[model samples]
Structures are given as C-alpha cells and as structure tokens.
Target: EAAAPRQSVVRRVAASSELVQNVAELAGIFSCLEEAFMVYSTRKAIAIDELMEGSRVSSVVEDVFYVLRKCARRAVATGDSDCACSVVNHVCAVLSQRLYVELEMRVGQIGRNKERTLDLTREAQYEGLMEALAEQWPMVEGSDDAVNTSSASALGASAMDLSTVSLGSAGPGGVDHSVLGDGSGGMSSTISAEAAFWCLSVNNVEAAADNVATVKATLEEEVRLVFDDELESAKLASCIAELDTVRNDFKKRLQTGMTKLCASLSPRLRSALGVMDGASAIVKYELTEAEFADNDGFNPFVHEFLGALERILAPHAAVLSPALFRTMVFKVAGYLAKQIK
Candidate 1:
C-alpha cells in the first residue's frame, strides 16, 4: 500500500512538471515570434520610399499584411488559443503604433507642404500685380522724370512688403519654409512624389480595412475548425474582435485622410475660382447687344476658369480611388455653389 501511494504521488508530480515545461516552451516561441515581427515590420516601414509607384495600395502595406497573416496562421496552427491571441495582439500593436502612425505623418507633411506652395504662388501673383500697377500708373507727383522715380520707389516698397511677409510666414504646425522649395529641380520631384505618396496612403488605408475583414473571416473559419472546445472557440472569438477594432480604426483614418486631401485641394480650386470674381464684375454692368453676341455669348472667363479647374483636378483622377475622387468632386461642387451664392 505504501509503495502504490508513493508511485501515484510521483506520477502526479511528473504530469505537473510536463505541463509547466510545455507552457514555458510555448511562451518562448511566442516571445521569439513577437520579436521577429517587430523587426520585420520596422524594417519594412523604414524601407518604404515616398516616390515608389503604386496604384491601389502601397507595396509596404501589402507586404506587412502578408507577413502578419502568415504569422497569425502559424500561431493558429499550433492549436493553442493563447498563442493565437498573443499573435493577434502583437499585430494590432504594430499596426496602431507603427504603420498607421507613419502613414498619418506623411499625409500631414504633404498637407502642410501643399499649403505652403499655394501661399508662395499667391505671393508671386501679388508681386506681379504690384509691378504691373506701378508700370501702368507711375504714381507721379511732379514730372515725367519724377514718374519713373516714384514708380521705382513704389516697386521697391512692394518688394519689401513681399519680403517681410515671406520671411515672417510659417505654415500650419510651423513647418519649415525650406520644404516648400529649395530652388532645385529635385525639390519639385520630391514634392510631386510626396503628393503621390499621400494619395497612395489614402488608398492603402481603404485597402487595409478590406484586408483586415478578409483576415478576420479567414481566421474565424480556421479557429472554428481547429478549436473544438467551446472555451477555446470563445477565446478565439474575443481575439478576433481585436481585428474588428483595428478595421474600424483603418476606416476612420481613411475618412480623415480623404477629408484632409479635399481640404488641401480646395485652396487651389479657390484660387482658380478667383477668376469668377472678375467675371462677376464684368457682368455687373449692362452689356451692349454686340458684346452679348460676341463669341456666341460664351463668357471667356468661365471657359478659362473651367480649363484651369480641369487642369488642377486631372492628375488626381489617376491617383485617387474612385470613391475618393467622387468625394472630391462633390465637395468641390458644394464649395463652388457656396462661393457663387
């Protein structure tokens, strides 16, 4: 009886030791996987070039998600709910803290840079106007010689005003003026590439939401098949809910990005719409019959304004997704209507 009791105690201790060992090994595996994911995601995020060509979604976005799906599937294949949950949690953290933040920063930079460029263009136009006015009406106080001198003084004063404004200026968030331009050919390319990248980011967010949904469905199906225990299945369901949260986050970011993009583009459209003010002034007066019939009564300013608007929007059509492009169009139309009113 004593020997049998001792053997039973030994067997129980051995079983407990085996369980602890299995838990430790599982933990070690999970830790290694998490570290590897972090390194891979960091490298991929850093390696992305703003100038890289992408149509619907960025290559980096696709690559990162591919790795994430593989990792998640591998964890699920282990038939361990805790292991799967650990991987999912790590994915959410990587996306929320790293990839999403990077894309948001890029979009913000583009908006600030674009606003600065628009400001510079407006300043240049003002300078041109001042020069033209000085040439046309020389601000003469005394003689024809005085006319030239006075005009020169006026031009100098205008230049000083422009210099003061430009020097004092800072963009939203106090962005450095150097980012607007550096008087080099490369700067133009950089700005263009960044703008294209901004568009890519918007599309990538939309794609990410879709990809997350697909991943959730796949993981859920696999979890149901692999986990027969009700408790394990329930735990997996809870883990999958984290993806739903992530997908919602992506959706929110997508909306915000689209709104910011539309807002950035608005200034350009508003500048183009300035011609309408000139047109309104022209039409405020009574037109002669001949003037009404001129050029089949087509307003030249309207035609020119439409052409300018088209030129501004043409590049966006190719880069932005269909839904985003439609949103931009509707927003522009509403703005136009409001301005006209």
Candidate 2:
C-alpha cells in the first residue's frame, strides 16, 4: 500500500512556489514580532516609569497581536496544514501568553493619575480602530457556513468558520483563519482587535506625555541657569530671552489646543512670571566689598561641592522663586566662604 502523505512536513514535490512563499512569509512575521519585543524590552529598561505614561506596554501588546493575526491570515492562504498549525500555535503563544505577561508587569507600575489618562486615551483609540478595522474586515451574512476539520484543531478553536472567513466578517472577539492542518486551528479576533486598540492608544498617549516632559525640561534648564554666577552680567538679558521664547511657544500651543500640556508646566510658569520683573533688580543688588571678601574668596575649590550643593539646593530647586534663588546664591556664597576658613 502507498504510504500516506506526511502531515507535518511540507513536501517540495507537492507544494507550489506560491505556497512556499507563503510559508516563508510566516517565518518573516515571527521575526518581526521578536524584533518588536526586543525594542519594547529595551525601552522599558531605559525608563519604565516614563514609558508607562506613554502607554508603551499597551502599545506593544496591541502591535504583537495585530501582526500575529496577519500571520494567521497568510498562513491559511498557503494551503499547508502543517505550516498553518505551526503558525497558529507560535503566534498565539508569543502574543497572548508571553507578550501579555510582559505588558502586565509594566502596566501594574503606572501611577493612578497616568492610569486614568491612559484609560481615556484607549477608549478614543479603540473607537477609531474599530472603524478602521470595519473597512478592512468586511463581513457578509449568509445561511451557509463553511467549516474546517483539520488535525490542527489541537490549537485554539475559534468561533469563526474558516471557509467563510472574510477580513470583515471575522469580527472582533474571535479567531478567523483561512485554513489549518489535518485537525483544526485558527487566530482569535478578540485578542487581535484589543491589541490594535491599545497599540494606537499608546502612540497617542506617549506623544502627549513626551510633550509634557519636553516642556518641563526646557523650562527647568532656563530657570536653573538664571542663578549661574557665570552669567551674572547677562542674567537679565538671558532670563528675558529664554522666558520670552518659552512664552511664545506656550502661546502657540494654547492657540493650537494644548491646554493640558500648558497646565503641566505650572512650576515653570510660576517661576517665569515672578522672575521676569525681579531678575534685573536682583542682578544689580550691590554686594559689599566686605561681603565678597568675608566669603573665603570667589569660586573657592570645594572637594564636596556637588554633594554639599545638592544638600543646600534640593529644597530650593522645588520652589525656586526670584527671591528664593537670590537667597540660595548668597547662602551658597557664604557656605563656600566658610568652607575655606
């Protein structure tokens, strides 16, 4: 008797070039998923706190699942049962199990304030994604439904009927596949749709978070430089220049509807508004020759300058008003003078 065809191996003698290409595409899809995971891990390592604000975890979860859905669609198209089974198992395990765990860990770390913001952002993104997916996976209603009886059924069973599966009819909560091995196997639409929603949401939230960080950092840099003894002569000119530039940018953002981002820069705004009028007066505040000489000397070398400076400046950095900054300068000058004596 003739031996039955091997279900696990793709026979070169029997498989067409197009079928082979589809199998190769499945491998490529896995590579893409692995690479994306690597990128997500690296970014998380750099700053889990900040990235969580950006919705990095949710974004990666969505991206990996979406790609897996596409992989399943293409795998079924190849008409190779073994390849399709492998595709389904591999994609599902990576996206739903492994990727899900990694994402959960980061999501657990998000602060309550950021978590609320992320929830709102996700809802908006989900609606937009639902509309977009609607166009991609149009479903047709009919009385006849096509079914598969492949051995690949060992994989997760999807409610979606493989034979009748269209991109649109696949819906959002189940798996839809073109074909599978001798048993039965398929992709889950629910996971895929959920992932797509979160991925888009993360992109949106991350952009907004980054904008806030950027504005806060820029303002802090200028505010700190205001007290740099090196820049005493140019203090007024520099403070006005920097604050004016920031104000223009702030006004522009206000015009463009970035009120929330503007609000986030409250510390910067308070300092700028209070300092613009007082910087010149403080700069011109006359220092007595005795006051300067009383201090050990100008710019005396201190071995523990950084540590000591941080100890002195930590509290002040938080509430650095013009008067406060001036106080810090005189205090620091006196401390430095005492260090030598």
Candidate 3:
C-alpha cells in the first residue's frame, strides 16, 4: 500500500524550494525581529529606550506578528514542509514563556504620556480615527511615488474576507514566479491590492537567532567584567556613562526613524488604520498565541513592511551612524538584562 502522506513532511518538502530564492531574506526577517527584541533587552549597551514610545512600540509589536503571519500564510497555503523552520526563526516565539513579565518593568519607559495613552485606550473608538487614517493613506506601492493623499471609497470599515483574492493570468509586475524546488507553485495576485513583496527575506531565506544570543551574552559578560560581580554596583561607570549617551542618541534617532516610518505610511496608513479597527476584535490576542491566524492579508505585509522600513531608515540613518546602529543591538540587550537582573 502507498504510505499515507504525512502532512508535516509534505509541508516541509513544499516549503524548501520557496526558501531557495536568497538565504538572506529569511535571516533579515529574523534579524529585524531580533533587533526589535534586542532593543527591548539591551537598554545598557546601545540605549534603544526611545523605542519604548507606546505607538512606536505597538507598531513594532504589530510588525512582528505581521511578518510571522505572512510567513505562516505562505507556509500553509503552499504546504511547505519547512514551515516549522520559519516558525523556529522567530526570537519572539523562542523567548522564555514569562516573557510578558519583562513588559511590566518597561511599560512606563516605552510609551507616550500616561494620560494620553489612557485616553487613547477608551473602550469605544471613534469614527474620526478612521477618517483621519483614510485621509493619510489611500494606497501604497513599493515604487517610491509621492504619498497619496486620496481616500478609498472601499465600503465599510469592517474586517475583510481575504479568500476572495484572485490570481488571474499574469500581468506586468503584477506577479512573478519566485524560485522554488520541484517547480509547480506560482499563483500571482494583482499588484494593485495590499500585499507585501515576497522578496529574498521571507520567501526562500533561513535566519539563525543564536548569533543574537551570543551577542547578548558577550555584552553582558563584558559589562559584568568591568565592575567585578556586582553588576549594579560595578560602575567604572564609563560603560554606564557611554550607555546614557548612547540611549539619548538612540532615542533621538529612533524618534526620527519613527517619524519617517509614520510619513511613509501616508500612502498606506488607511489600510493600517482599517487594520487597527479590526485588530482588537479579530486578534484580541492570547497570552499563549497571537489572536488571529494567518489570513491572506498577512503574507503581503512582508513586502509592505520592507517598503516602510526602507523609507523610515533612509531619512534617519544619517542622524545615527552605522556603528551606533550596530551597537544598538548590544546596548538594548544590556539594558534589559540590567532591568530584570
């Protein structure tokens, strides 16, 4: 008798080819997640505390889930065997289960003013918020055109059904076949709708997270070594001094990064705003897992996010030098370790 196919194994086999496009794509996604997490962790080394801004922090959280969701949708839709491989790359998933515990300590440091954050959290959200959102972002594409100020008349602000997407006969730039193993899996969607590109990062890439762990551990060790064993007491204080300077600098640049990210959204902000309306209900979120599973909209955000990040980084990279940006990873981890320790 022909052996019954193992869905897990079949899925794994299917995902392998899609991953062959460019290995860096996978790593880059993980690295972005790791960088976000490390920024959460190391407040001491590079001083990424400004990433604590509530809206900014929320955006980062949204970004993490978005990429993961995108990865998952492609994995399931295509039945890629390497699905779990992508899941494993998520540092957010791998962190200790009590991970939420860390949020308790950092909440105050990472958000907008308390009264404003509280006011924004009222049970009933306003329709004006939607209008504000629509006014900002009508439609966005990867190609850098001026941010569209037009509004979409797309009916209600309700949660959308994603399965309706059509992968018709190919049109220019609308769809392109990505390299994958054993061929036979290229369904293309019209480029007009909201979707992220499946470039080198998410499609055929594998990222490793252990390197980040090593970076964290080493920074901690170096910091600890400077002050004897009393991590708190140990302050040749030059490290602390540098960290303070770094944090201030990182904060300034992060604000700049956030502004760029925000400005870039002028074209896609409405979609994201619509996303915000449904976000609470659809994915009320679970302590155990994200609220909603990967729907079709998820896969495309990968492309959208890359476009957003590029715009955000472009304006701010000059304000923050490459060395500091690289060190931000270590500094964020350092700060977090200090906070919890």
Candidate rank order under lDDT:
1, 2, 3
Output the number of the lDDT-best candidate: 1
Candidate 3 off by > 4 Å: 1-220, 223-235, 268-341
RMSD of each: 15.5, 30.7, 26.1
TM-scores of all candidate predictions against the true structure? 0.64, 0.21, 0.20
Alpha-carbon lDDT of model 1: 0.58
Residue-level lDDT tens digits of model 3 in 22-117: 544654564455445543443222121112221112122333333434442333233222332333233333322222222222222221212323
Where does the lowest 10-residue lDDT sum fall in candidate 2? 140-149
In order of listing, the candidates' clash counts read 0, 22, 30
| Candidate 2 wrongly placed segments (more than 4 Å) | 1-58, 107-341
Among these predictions, the greatest TM-score belongs to 1
Q: What lDDT would each prediction earn against the true structure?
A: 0.58, 0.34, 0.29
lDDT of 1 at 61: 72
